[model samples]
Target: MMNWRSAPLAPATASQTASSEHADERIKLSDEQVAAAQIKLAPVETTQLAEHFLATGTIVPDADRIGRVAVRVLGTVTELRKRVGDPVEKDAVVAVLESRELSEVKSEFLAARLTNDLQQTLAARYKMLWESRSYPENEYLKSRLTAQDARIRLDSARQKLLALGLNEAEIEELPNLPIEELRKQSLRSPIKGRIAERRVDLGALVGREGQESELFVIVNLDTVWIDLAISPTDLSKVAENASINVTAGPDGPNGVAKIIFVSPLIDKDTRSAKVTASLDNAESKWRPGMFVTAEIPVPGRGAVLAVPKAAVQTIEGAPTLFVREGQEFVARKVQLGHEDDNQQEIVAGVNAGEVIAVSNTFTLKAELGKSEAEH
Candidate 1:
């Protein structure tokens, strides 16, 4: 065993000479106490502590990939194929609505088309007869005007069906559709995503004038938005497309993500700017609404004196480290600098190559506090 009884004390000023000696007194631990205290020690040394800024945020749905499914026609929902959490395909059918109003529109379209066809034939015949001098010019002109009006009415009726979600193929086939099929409108999803919400039920009355009834909300989870709040002091430290490591609880990141968006508007209440990061959630590890921590590495000023975070102890509101000399653990005041996840840089009152307590520092503080009370 090494001897510390003969070791000389550190030099101090007139005001601190007495207090410093008291603070630097040794912590005498029996072999059993040392084992029970779980003391760990490491040399006070410089370490390359890459700087990082921590910000909190939550995973949210990417706006570009989210879609709200709604119906335009006045109808009653007859069938719902997908429920919440179901995976869907692009242009997939989400639900079916039965509407008498739609059926009436189809009937008007069929009637208008027949009228247009009849008028067209009459106008052609009148033109031929007028060229042959077998019909009057005024009769031909009147027939031509009738044909044009019928054609306009036919186009208007077709457009009304189109606005109700019928494609060109379905519009073309509508004239021949059976009465039952003509009234059934299938609500289709516009994009590929998972069903996030279901707002309609079977036999539910839906669709109103000047408004659309939302049936399902689909969201693509392949990519998710990380909604982060950056404080005013840290706003400049983070920027668009900066590399980030997101973590769950205290663990390391599940995967790397990049800052995609940063809001210019600062929140009045929190005094923080909104920032966003896009992460690949193909494996679905980072799910929406899950709170996470984002660690962004910023440029460091330069190297400085540093040590493991565990080496520092809070004794009477001051940061202190227990230095080891010849088996003696002495409390030493320390000044700290830039810190990150792994290390804390020591600015003053500690020198390189000195052994300091790295773990179980609370035990040393408690022991020192008891001795100080006794004195």
Candidate 2:
């Protein structure tokens, strides 16, 4: 009877005892046993330590290098010679305008030239008379002054025409041409570049008072820009003239870039500093507003002691890792630096070529937690 009914087992007490025993068994391994278990742990691959900085950016045209072509006078666009994306040379004719003002300017220049010729003949005659003592010095001087005034008027008229894109020789020859042909003015491209924009179509009246319309926009696509917005915290890591890598497509056709400028002011809303990098676009494959990824290499303090990021663990906000000594893994604290998405830099508490648990760190952590609970 004593053996069969030994304090009729309580189901709750029995269950509790079983759980405690299981927990005790989990932490029952001696130090020597733990050392043996750790020997079975796999070694993590070692990597050379280096500094890395992450940033996102986009491709844009260098605005300072862009050029614009606009109509100089109010006129109807008689001809639209260039379309968007057409390559143009310096001083090439991009469009033609027919304007009444241009015709008037040509006429004024012709009349001034004729008056100047007549005055020149009179002044020459006065000079001969004065030299021969047939005219007073003052009279000859006055005549000469009148002739000089007329010549000045002619020069002013010629310059006005030239300011309107008319050559001086062209203005002098305009009166010989038909009136209908003289009225048309050709607008030329000022720079060698491709047409990036076209605002006016054929027959569009541009250059009206108070109307600042842009007839065309030209961009020199031989060089491009990489606009990177870097956080203020990382601004110190960048340097002007530093080299960077630029990837164009999704998979990336990689190219090299040089840091051109870094803005001193931070964006009010985003608090990020703007950095610009220049790239050669000689092939014209990169276009404005194209999305791109840029990688800027930040110099590190040469080689340093480090470990794989996965090997590091956080125990109550303290960064820790398992140091495999002999057959045992003891938890050790470490100071970290420059942690990228893949790997972390260990400034202290570890050395190169040392084996650490990387893949199954969570399992080790769980084992530690269970041991603590049992205690």
Candidate 3:
């Protein structure tokens, strides 16, 4: 440290002084770099990486399998134990009908049976006499014809009872029980389902077989139908066995449905075709008339790079994107694929995990336009 300041002054040439001044200028520029040349970066969120499609539809019951149980005979409802949404077993009594016509049919069937039995006994006697030559052949033949006519009458009467909704078992059991007691016929559920509608109240009169009166409508809710209306252009995308996602409420149970049928005809007014999807509704959460939104996934064109819809921009009718390169963003033209509601498919010009300007993409675009003009 001996005379260090005096030794530095001894070599104070012009070149040395200019070198010091250059160093001071460089330090000053470094201090002002942030304010003079800083780039305004736009913060953005990353896009989701997955495959999905969106569709809107409504929920409905399978009408083909659903049935309405009605009274075969016109009568007052003597008993109605079931209500809407009540699960009913097949052949379970849902209501009771007091019908005088049912009693008359049962009485006719009994009389026909008595006549058939008497004719059978007389025919047997005639057959024995003819075999022993005690009766003429024509007389025996006539007696046999009479027996056939009686049997025909019996069959006719049995058919009438069947047409009246009486099963064979009930017809056979009729003679064993009092006919008057069977006047109040219990209407059983024709199918295993939940009661969807009830039109007849207690003591209300219902129509008979010839009349048109819907007493109760039961629907098998174990399997439901999702009616999705697809636009004519998208109709070809929907195929048999296409996978669908069914949602009930905003945040309710979700179920998978399969495209069962696509209507061959397009709706004249809506210009859309009905695409039917079958879903399992054993939980009973999906009602017949409830509206639902369905997401039907059409076949994708293989996996490709994609980004958020917001990250993309349009330049001269071409889709453009801002790709981050080092500390700067570069404008690039990209080929796009099918676009959904939120995201679009990037077919080319970008790779996975590459940062893209999503928010304030227009600002990046403006910078790109300026750079292009300057060049």
Candidate with top TM-score is: 3
Model 3 clash count equals 0
The lDDT leader among the candidates is: 1
Deviation (Å) of 199 in candidate 2: 1.9
- Report the CA-based lDDT of candidate 2 relative to the real structure: 0.74
Arranged by TM-score, best first: 3, 2, 1
lDDT of 3 by residue, 28-123 (tens): 111122123332333333344444455678888887768877767777788988999899998888888888888887888899999999999999
Off by over 4 Å in 1: 1-50, 118-144, 209-212, 250-253, 299-375
lDDT of 1 by residue, 1-375 (tens): 323233322222235434345633566553344545677777887767789878899989888999988887788888999999999998899999888888888889999999999999999999999999999999999999999999999999999988888777777887677777988988888789999999877888888852348889999989998999998888888878888988868563467889988898999998889998999888878778899988888877777789888889888788998887654577788898889887998999889999888988887777677666656
Better of 1 and 2 by TM-score: 2
What is the TM-score of each predicted model, taking all chains together? 0.64, 0.67, 0.69
- Candidate 3 has which clashing residue pairs, if any? none
The TM-score of predicted model 2 comes to 0.67
| Candidate 2 wrongly placed segments (more than 4 Å) | 1-50, 167-176, 209-212, 299-346, 349-375
Prediction-by-prediction clash tally: 0, 1, 0
* Clashing pairs for predicted structure model 1, backbone only: none
Q: Is candidate 2 or candidate 3 better by TM-score?
A: 3
